[model samples]
Target: MNELQHETSPYLLQHANNPIHWKAWNDTSLKAAKNENKLIIVSIGYSACHWCHVMEHESFEDETVARVMNANFISIKVDREERPDVDAVYMKAVQLMTKQGGWPLNVVCLPDGRPVWGGTYFKKDNWMDILGQLQNLYTTEPERMMEYAEKLHQGIQILGIVEKNHSEAKSNPNNIKPLVEKWSKSFDWEFGGYARAPKFMMPNNYLFLQRYGYQTQSKDLLEFVDLTLTRMAYGGLFDTVDGGFSRYSVDMRWHVPHFEKMLYDNGQLISLYSEAYKRTQNPLYKNVIEKTLTFVERELYNSDNAFYSALDADSLNEVGVLEEGAFYVWKKEQLQQLLKEDFEMFAALFNVNDFGYWEHDNYVLIQSQSAETIASQFGLTENELLDKKKNWEQLLFNEREKRPKPRLDDKSLTSWNAIMLKGYVDAYTALGHEHYLTVAKKNAQFITDKQWSTDGFLWHSYKNGKSTITGFLEDYAFVIEAFIALYQATLEESYLHQAKQLIDYCLEHFYDEEKQFFTFTSRDGEQLIAPHFETEDNVIPASNSVMANNLYVLGILFHNGYYEKTALQMLHHMIPNMDYASAYSNWLNLWLNQSDDNKELAVCGKNALENIRKIQAEYLPNIILAGSTKASELPFLQSRFDEQNLLFYICQNKNCLLPNTSLETTVAALKIS
Candidate 1:
């Protein structure tokens, strides 16, 4: 066993008992490598990565492979979650060298921590051959390794630059339409998701198009949006047996999946689908939102009402061999036995035939048709079909429970929890369901009580009653977003005030004055070999874009000139690269809203909170509501609340129309603007 046994990351602890001595990334490990004159082998992966486990069991566990690793290098294992800054630099190096990258990232570095060469997953023989050759080359030609390391170091320093500032800024909504239309045409209209195999459900991309569709009243954009979400909902990528989505679909048709479910993907998906449901009122979107939320509550949530990170992709099969889809795939005989009378109906509706069959004749269920159509063809009512499906699903779920379960990674990350919290808030706001609000409030309280410090700062990770690691810019950015969302949902001033304090903290510490964007790590945190200013969107939206969004909201709430100026500067920085707008769609969306006529609805007096709800049920993305029961909460509502009467005030740019008690009157006035 090595030092990883004492660490908190599940990824590191998984290798605690390996034959090769492994060390967590720290100053001591780097110092030891330099002192011993050994090269450093840095292998980074996460807990839920399937190939990471494959590498561990295949190469790291072999005694001879361990000997080769131990004698020639100082091996280090890093969980990308605990130290993303380190991961970011090395991943960039690998991408620059090879033009592609994924998890199980293996890099050979010098003692000073500059990566020279790297590649992703390798077979055991290829891995051993490469290690032997690396050691031989290092000893025979030391100068060659040093030269490559220096070159890679220089390249890493210049990666991912969003412009410090831009010239000739303008808010033209027309510029975005062509780019979005071109990207939308790439969709796999017959199936779901974008064209090609290995499809990822990028929720923000859909959300941007969705909001644009609603704003422009474009039938084509709306139809594309509906088609993508509908196909995904019916595809095998969604766990038809369960209620959550896997990480991504491995096929364009969404018939096969890589089956690891992550909290971040599900969280963003909930928000995206809820907003779509609110705009279109499609029952398909509503069913997805509610079922996904149910899955989260059942499997991912902890006792503290916070969320865990993910579920593993692999589980043990009936023969005691480790397999990838053991927990999910079903045999044809098992279905027939379980759903005796309804076997044909269930099998036909869910495509349990050869079309859905995978390796060894096991099936991954993918929807073949809508329930209404199937019911009509089968000479039954829709209600009868629904009841039959639900009953058969419950039976399958019960039988599936008898199999070995997949591993669950229980680390509670502040940034991911914040995303899920935002998901709950969006669901509540869109659906006006009391339980969703209650859940959102509970998670918000959990973060405030546990992850936040007394000085109003934040922590990155919390597990087993302890929260450690200084907060990165992402933790603060996402949590601030959640706070702003809560304030909108409940009209609670404390949430708004707390969000302001967090933004001020970012301004003081995370901001780079010369770069004009926030760094991924705080100035006070332990420095990495290379600092990163992340401004592009990936699986999650970039921190810079999220911060820009927070600044925009705060600017409107308090009428702060500084906040508006900074937000506009960030938006201008994005203008030069509008051609790559799909990756930066979240940041580009700020301008989409700016291109429209926005309004602020300020409600006051005794029934102000009640009055706010009348507007809440409607789809009003352009409307901002601020309410005060008495006075002094909002600056504009200082004396607007009278002693006896309730009123609605429509205001924009410090101009108020009139205060009246009629909801329709306020709606009519808002429409005219």
Candidate 2:
């Protein structure tokens, strides 16, 4: 079992029985490496990574490779999700060393932990040869190794540097149009994502685009968004039989997914689809929101209501061997046998023959045409086609459930749980579902009760009723964002108060004064080779960007100038770096709010709750809602309450309009503004 047998992370425990002597990333293992003067081999991967599992079988499980690893180096295994700080530093080093980086990230570092060499997955022979070469170089040419490590360490230090921009470049809505125009050149007009293979569902990018399209009334951009959302939901990336999304599609058309279903992806995608549904009233988007939530609750949700990390891409096949996408993909004969008379229509609808064909005689269900298009060919209405799809889904789902399920990475992460919490809130807001709000509150309560600390801090990972790792900035950022959303949804003052308290903690511990940006790790947490300020918005939006957005919202709600200035300052710092629209999508979204004159809608009176519901039903991205059924202590809602009649005060930049009793008129003012 080596040293990882006692670790709580599922990824670490997966390696407990490996032939290689492995240790979890910690002070004890690191100190032992220094004591023995051995080179450190840091291998980072998550449990759901299919390539990580393949590498484990090909190299780490081999006796000869393990002997070499055991003899020349102290091997440290890191689950990237659990220890993102470690992964960030090493990943930066690898990307600098080579031109690319990926999972099962292997790096050889000097005893003091400066990375010297690294790569992604390798075959057993290549892995052994690389280790042998590194060991030989260390013994025979020590100075050369030291020089390389020093250079790499310096590069790592500069990777995430955010210099404050003193220029008074206006956070203009005009600037976004040119940037989107430049970014639009790369869009795959046919496939709905960027013109590239291995497409990711970058929710923030579309989120920003959705807002910009509606605000600017750009039909082209809005149509692009609709195309992208519809294609993604129709593609194999979305599990038709099950209900959630896989991590990403391996092809340009979103035809075949890499197959791992991650909590962060599903959570963010939910918020995206829900907002789209609100804007367009697309039945497809609503179906995606409901189905994905069902998947999360059924498969990933804990008894405590917090979500687990992910579902493994690889599961046991019929012959009892680990194969990627085994549980999700189906055989043509099996489908024909199961459906019988209905097989012909089902095959036509889902493209089961040539277009959906994957390797090994397996077919990944993919739709090239919409249900409306397919229904026309089959001489049926769209509703009829959808009804048939539902029945087919039920039958296929039951059969698939009989197969071995993919392994679950059962550890609950605070940042991801918060993301899912916001998903539920957005779902409830868009759909007006009371049960969604109830589930969101339950998860919010779970986070405060279990993951949060009385010392104005949070824990990063929780499992088996224990949380030992200090929370990173990502945890605090997403929780604050989610709490603020929850406050808007339920008008619960406690949630708002808790959000303010979290931001206070972040300001003290995670904020960097000189950079005017938040650090990825708290000041009191463990420091790595270099500090990282995650700025780029990937599948999950960057922590600093989310924090900046939260500051902007809370500042308006609580009337704090410092928070407002800090949010703008952070945005100004990012202006020079906004070369790629998708990467800086969250930052751009914040800029959108500022440029559009974001309003504070305060609903206070006898029908405040009822008015709040009507307001939420509209797709108004440029509003911070605050309400009270009667009187309230919040400065934004203070003295504006009257028990006699409903009132809506639309305020911008601390200036308020006269209280209007008409909900319809208020909504019209928001739309026109």
Candidate 3:
């Protein structure tokens, strides 16, 4: 029986009708394996993964392969997104056995669910051959299978292993710069991003580079940062017509991307671009930031105000054949017909020539030249070209909408949605836009009402009016981080109070006193083969790393040295791998922040909200803003309320300068003193 029909995961639903008899991961499935004395074949993948879809079509759909699987093994289909804990254990096992790991991960494990052999995305012939061999070896040579499982299980458990760092222990702030310069050699200065074929838009690397370049006044570094951002915005990685970035570019030039847009990627990119815009006031960054948010609101957002996880990579084309990038790619004839008068200029502006070609005479709509430059070539003023361009984009966008839409994974995750929530908050802070703030507060309210429990716990995922799975450290850490951002955005004390409660809950449940770091699962959740502590940065910053940053920021908010020390210790354990710090850029950023001169921009009076809005218009990453319309006792807000004038003051480390009765003098004072 296919138990996947009972599962809530979209990835599982995508396979619910497979020829194989599939069971969703549960005690019943594992128990069936043990009771029947059959090997367990655990296949894990996410809904939007392109290769996962390919494998499903090739192997899982074949009746012959289904017979082999159903006869010899108790087959379980696990959605990596919904059951990441299970995926993590098996993925680690696969990576240990084979040097690489990705989804459509197939792991052949013991009846007890201890992984013995694993690999990803095999063809029908290859799948049958491997399955037959594994089944034979398991039954005929039980001792060999047991040996492999025992050792591989131990290896997977120890992979996230943390170690002490002498560089961090020495407490020298100067040590990080040389390593940053060394690691930067890999950057693709001309094309943007780290030099590679499949370029992921790892937002942390650019965030670190931009901040480090600005703080150190390194002109070359700053130029590299700007070049990267500009090129990426112009590239196919960014959706020019619609909005939101794809997963990554398949080519080194960022010309053609893997069209699926993950919520986490767009959310982090929005936050990154928001900060970049604040620092440089670049129109390109602001444009991309706003457009991406528009895409989120239009597509990824659920009617209930919660964000969805992703959009599938494959969709039906005009002829209804399922194809990758079908929704995004365009034939030249389609564009030429739509923009008959403006076709020549549009083609030139977007590089619809052979240079922009992807596959089958289609272009991904990547911008090769800016409108200003293209306007000159077309014998038109910039404004005239811009007017034509805007009109053309809307027409093309509307036309594209009439085509088949990609499948949306409607599962809402606490961690991913929280990241998007922080993105909106950052967008509001950078742009001083009320709409972004409204969106952020709306999402926050929805999470509090839906995913969160009245008893102060969180659920991991929600879909179709049902929330399932226990919340992991990531859910707690990111929500805690988002709540802090919310408090800073609104200064609503309830937000702070909620953040504190979440953090306390994390400390009580996720923290390991011996390791001094968080395990990925809560103490209350079912333990995996081994408890995992994710501390490295990948596509997402490690949950533990994000938690440490929350502790550091919360320490500043509450003047708690103990919290600060714990955050410092977490960094200390990671700082020895200086070259790897590029991947750990979030941790390094937190470390650098420890020495940053803290600024408190306090606005107190009946008109404090207006003053806060004005003060926040500036890009002050190192400052904490406190506002009160009346008297308050909060540490950051103590005695800040004024009865007479709209008083403003600048304070540093508990020493405040003379209070100003006007916002003008206060803004000027912050300029130099």
Candidate 4:
């Protein structure tokens, strides 16, 4: 075992027994690199990454490769989930050098830690050759490597340059339509995602599109969102037998998933499907939400009610080799033997023949036909088909459990847990599930008790009853957002107050005054090669974008003019940099809030809580909610609380429509229904 044996990250622990002497990223390892004048190999990947495991087996375990790495370099293993700051700086370097980047990110840095060379996964021979060449280059002429490292470090520093746009004209609903038009050219109208292979379920993209489509009354865009959501849910990207989504599909059709399930993806997806359900009342979306939450609960939910990070993509197959998708994929013979008389119907519903066939006679269950279509073809009722489907799932789930399950990355993260908590809040609001609300509150309380500190800040990661790692901006952003959602759901002033406190902490620690944007790492945290402004929306929305949107929401909820102005200023700085709408979907969502139709749904009266619940159930994308059952000092609810009757006021920028007692009439006035 190496120094990594002492690490808490599962990814670092996976490398603990490697022949290579791997050390976790810390002051000791870094100081050793500079003291010895040895090159630093900073390889970053999460535990669930299949290619990361592959590289570990093919190269790090080999004695010859280990000798070279151990002698020439000080190796540091980083779980990207745990140290995103490290990953961000090095990833930017790799992207600058190669114009692209992915997991199993391997970078060779100078002794002081400026990256000299970097790439993603490489073959053993290539990896060894590159290491040898780089070592020889440094040994022969150290100045050459230093020069390149300095130049690359400079490039990395300016990667996410955000210049403040001093335009007085704010981004409105119509101003962004042309940006969507530019983005629409890449949309795979037939496949439901972008026109590309390896489709990621970018939940926030669809989220923004759904809201924009509905608000603009664009039938084409709305229909496109419906098609994308339905196709994604039906595809093999979604676990038909289980309940959650894999990370991304290897194909555009969403027919072949990469097979790792991430907490962040599933969490955002729940919010997407839940909101879509409210708008369209699609039963399929509800099923996806319920099933996905079930998957989360069964696999990732911790004893403390917070969620774990992820499940690994690879698991031991029948042959005892680690294989991707082994636990989920099934052979035709296995399905035939299990289903018997129901086999034909099942095959038709989830394409089991040629369409579903993968390598090695395995079939990944992907629905090509809708349940209604399959039921009509089979001369069966919807209820009968639903029963058959449930039975088939039960049989398959039981059988699959007998196989070696995927390894769990059991460490919990503050940002991801908060995202999942928000998911539960959305599920409860949309479906009126008491259990969902109960679970959300429990998790929220757990975060407060365990992850939060008495000094008015949060810890980033928690495991084994210990919280470590100072909170990053992502942690504060998502938790504040989740707490606001909780306040909206229950109208608990304490949750709102908690969010306000966190927001103030972020302003003090994470905000960059000159850039007018938040940094990814807090000032209190360790400084990396360069500070990153995470602005792009990938699988998870960018931390800065989430923070900006949170600021906008809280500004309205609390009626704070200064907060609102700061949010707009941040948005102004980001507008010029939004080259891709999908990449900046969260930012665009904030832009949507600036539209004239946006409302502050303020309720204060005897039945305030009841009315807030009803208002949230409707698909009101432009509404920010706040209320109190009793008299409150919040500007939105001040002097408006009536003890005798429930009153709902639809206000915009402190101007109000006459308070109405009828929920239906008030909701209809917003033109939501």
Q: CA lDDT, every prediction?
A: 0.84, 0.91, 0.85, 0.91
State the lDDT of candidate 3 residue by residue for 119-154, as single tens digits: 998988998999999999998998999998898878
Off by over 4 Å in 2: none
Residue 350 of model 3: what lDDT? 87
> Model 4: per-residue lDDT, tens digit, 1-673?
9998998889999999998999889899999999999999999999999999999999999999999999999999999999888999999999999999999999999989899999999989999999999999999999999998889999999998787787887566678999999999998888788889888999999999999998888898999999999999996999978889999999888999999999999999999999999998998999999999999999999798789999999999999999999999999999999999889999999999898988999999998777888998989888789888888888999999899999999999999999999999999999999899999999999899999999888999999989999888899999999999999999899999999999999999889888888898888879998989988888888988898888888887777877888888878888888887889999999989888878888888878887788778889998888889999987778898888988888988678989988888888888743
Q: For candidate 2, lDDT tens digit of each residue in 595-641?
A: 65567899998778877987897899878888998799898888998
When sorted by lDDT, best at the front, the candidate numbers are 2, 4, 3, 1
* Cα lDDT of model 1 by residue, 90-110, tens digit: 999999999989889999888
Highest-lDDT candidate = 2
Model 1 per-residue lDDT at 355? 79
Worst 10 residues of 2 by lDDT: 164-173
Clashing residue pairs for model 2:
none
Candidate 1 regions exceeding 4 Å error are 653-656, 665-673
